[model samples]
Target: MKVVRSDWSRALLVCGKCSKKLDGGFGPKGRESLAKALRRHLGLEKGRRAAMGVIEVKCLGICPKRAVTVIDADDPHAWRLVDEGADLDAVVETLGLIRR
Candidate 1:
C-alpha cells in the first residue's frame, strides 16, 4: 500500500451542498465558500501540506437555513452549523484550529 505523508494535524469537512445552497455567503465580501474562506482565513494552502485540512464534501444532511455544516476531525462529537457571513476567527477558535 502506498502511504502519503502530510503535515495536517486534523481535518475539517465542510458540506458542499450547504455551501452551494447559500451561494457563496462566506468570506470578506461574502462571495466565497466556507472551505475557501476558512482556508484563506487560516492562511492555509490547498491539500495535506497545510497545518489543517479544510475539505469540501457532499451533503451532510443537516441542511440548516442560511448555514453550512462543518465537521472537525479532532472533535467529531459536536458538529458546527456556521451561519452565512459568520466570523472566521470565531469559527477557527471554536474548532481549535489555532496553531500552537
Candidate 2:
C-alpha cells in the first residue's frame, strides 16, 4: 500500500452541502465557504503540510436549518452546527485548533 506523511495535528470535516446552501455565509465579506474561511483565518496552506486540516466533506446526514455541520476528528461523537456568518474565533476555540 502506498503511504504518505502529513503534519496535521488535528482535522475537521465540514459539510459541503450546508456550506453551499448558505451561499457563502462566512469569512470577512461573508462570501466564503467554511473550510476556505477557516483555512484563511488559520493561515493554513493547501494540502497535508498545514498545521491542521479542514476538509469539506459530503452531507453529514444532519441537514440543519441555515447551519453547517462540522465534525472534529478528535471528537467525532459530538458534532458542531455553525450558523451563517458565525464567529470564526469561536469555532476555532470550540475545535481547539492551535495556529502554527
Candidate 3:
C-alpha cells in the first residue's frame, strides 16, 4: 500500500450526510456546504493546503437539526455542530485550526 504523508498539523472531518442535508446552507446567499465554504473561506487547496487538512467523510451518525457535525482530528474528545452561514472565521478560531 502506498503511504501518502503530509505536513498538515490539523485534519478536519466534515460530515457528508449532514452537509448534504443542509444543501449548500453556507457561504454567501447560503449556497455552500460547510466543507466547501470553509475551504473557500480559508483559501485552502484540495489536498495540500498549508498545514491543515479538511476532508469530507461518510455520515458521522450525529445528524443535527439543520446543521453539520464536525470532528476535529486534533481533538476528537469534543465535536462541533456548525450551523449554515455561521461565520467561517469564528469556526476556525473556535476550533483552533487557524488564526485569522
- Show the colliding residue pairs in model 2: none
Q: Arrange candidates by lDDT, descending.
A: 2, 1, 3
Better of 2 and 3 by TM-score: 2
Candidate with the greatest TM-score versus the true structure? 2
Residue-by-residue lDDT tens digits, candidate 2, 29-50: 8889999999998999878998
Q: For each of the candidates, give the backbone clash count.
A: 0, 0, 0
lDDT of 1 by residue, 37-66 (tens): 998888889988888889999999899999
Task: Single out the weakest 10-residue window by summed lDDT for candidate 2.
Answer: 91-100
Cα deviation in Å at residue 9, candidate 3?
A: 1.9
* Predictions in order: lDDT: 0.89, 0.91, 0.84
Clashing pairs in 3: none
Per-residue error for 83 in candidate 2, Å, reads 1.1
Candidate 2 residue 96 Cα shift, in angstroms, is 1.2
Ranking by TM-score: 2, 1, 3
lDDT of 3 at 30: 87
Whose TM-score is higher: candidate 1's or candidate 3's? 1
